[model samples]
Target: MKKCLKKLELKIYHVVKGEKIDGVHAGVYGDVTGIWGDVTGIEGDVTGIRGDVTGIWGNVSGIRGGVTGIRGGVSGIRGDVTGIYGDVSGIEGDVTGICGDVTGIEGYVSGIYGDVSGIEGDVTGICGDVSGIEGYVSGIRGDVNDAKLTDNERLSGIDVSQLIKN
Candidate 1:
């Protein structure tokens, strides 16, 4: 009888909205109101984040740090950010930041308040003020309130899969 069946183990835990989850979480989340720690190896939509986060994959919102495969609004990023792909908007930063190629942007992109580098993308119906920039942006339509370009070049290329850890 034992040879006819195989053993299996399953663990399931649901994370509610506005609840606090600390340490590393490797699973799917929905409408996450707050995350007090880093989320690694995530393969689903992570939304409504209200804290500092890092190393997140898939469509993410309201977070920062080494992120990849992200498709959402990013604000207040404060480090070397690499390998970001997909549609994004409202990227506001305060320190040295780096970004990869973006597909398209629509709406407002206000206040890149620090040294930003390597942002390559196409913009449509966008308006805002950028304090400093050292990257490339093409196909811009709309208005830029204020901008300061330093070098305007591609810094380096990075792979999206390498930014995550198992």
Candidate 2:
């Protein structure tokens, strides 16, 4: 019988295979890849994740959009979500969209795009793609490649003295 209905549709898509829509407005469209749960007040266009999006009005685009093993608390994403892959843990809020090539982020992302890796926390509105950042950055506008930070002295962007550790 069609291989027992394709092995019960791959065991019911490995026991529900993501996408827990909540408070339906537009009622979900395409590419919620392997969704787990908690898309709240969605209008349309969710690309991919394991779970937990609080509020999306519309336009959640995708390319390599797989937010793997996500923690929680993404407040907003407008559109053009891209290439966010692997071990995104303890995200706080406010990603306005156009995400690109983000990898293993810790928390508090704002906007803009480029290759980011192993970020820690308080990335106050990332503008032009930081790489290997550690902690306590005030305003990053562009290019802090392979950085490690502490000692809150209000570090600005454009390679602020290679993340000043005085």
Each model's backbone clash number = 0, 3
How well is each residue in 54-115 modelled by candidate 2, as lDDT tens digits?
Answer: 44455644434334433333433433344555434444343333343434444444432333
TM-score of each: 0.25, 0.17
Per-residue CA lDDT of model 1 for 1-166, tens digit only, reads 3566778998757734556557764655456454456645666665555655556555534434433333344554444443444444444434334354443343445444545444555434444454454333343444443433334321344332333233
Tell me the spans in candidate 1 whose CA falls farther than 4 Å from its real position. Answer: 1-99, 119-166
Highest lDDT scorer:
1
Worst 10 residues of 1 by lDDT: 152-161
Q: Candidate 1 — number of clashing residue pairs?
A: 0
The residue-level lDDT of candidate 2 at 150 comes to 36
lDDT of 1 at 155: 36
